[model samples]
Target: MHDSQVFFELLSENTSKEVWADSAYRSEENEWMLKAGGYRNRPLNKRAQQSNRRKSRIRARVEPVFGSMENEMGGLFIRMIGRARAKTKIGLMNLVYHLKRCASLWKSRQ
Candidate 1:
């Protein structure tokens, strides 16, 4: 399937009833799909903009980690062939991140 089809497929597989996504995922078809799947729409559109401010505050804390991954870890690109290998690569990257963070904290304490 295409990337767009995969997105909907993921939506269908999700356990949560409330979907929090970007405005780019907004559309009549997606909305209908979400509704049919018993999901609460929380796309970042104008009508829902106020709710996103609080979500954005929470998301801000997580954003810097991605920034560090890009700038420090040379990006989160897993150039592996399959999902299993990709998962392992990401797992190793996360392990490296934790080790680095631990070392930094230890040095700060010293």
Candidate 2:
């Protein structure tokens, strides 16, 4: 559930209504998310099940993102001299890491 809002925003921005996200987006407010009358409905076939499994795999990709943010970019807990400076530095480092990730993905695609 780390960066759930970011995950939601990425899904909404990148995917169309025709793509189903499996059982990951469930909420108390919206129980029947993937079971609704849209691309989310089960196709009653093996291929659809495989596709749903692949959709579920999308959640796994974020693990590497978190790993890089923690390990390659430095651990999560910051120990700076001042609170305000530490907060600002941490935000900058996070932004830098995200940009590096995007660039790496873009380069790999090309």
Q: Best by TM-score, which number?
A: 1
**Can you write out model 1's per-residue Cα lDDT over 1-110, one digit (the tens) per residue?**
54565678777677767667666777788888878877765445775687778788988988877777888888987788999998987887778888888999999999
Give residue 85's lDDT in candidate 2 (0 to 100).
89
Q: Indicate the TM-score of model 1.
A: 0.48
Please provide TM-scores, in order, for all candidate models, with all chains considered together: 0.48, 0.39
User: Ten residues in a row with the worst lDDT in model 1?
Assistant: 39-48
What candidate 2 gets wrong by more than 4 Å, as runs, is: 1-62
RMSD of 2: 12.2
Q: Which lDDT values do the candidates have, in the order given?
A: 0.77, 0.66
- Quick one: best lDDT, which candidate? 1
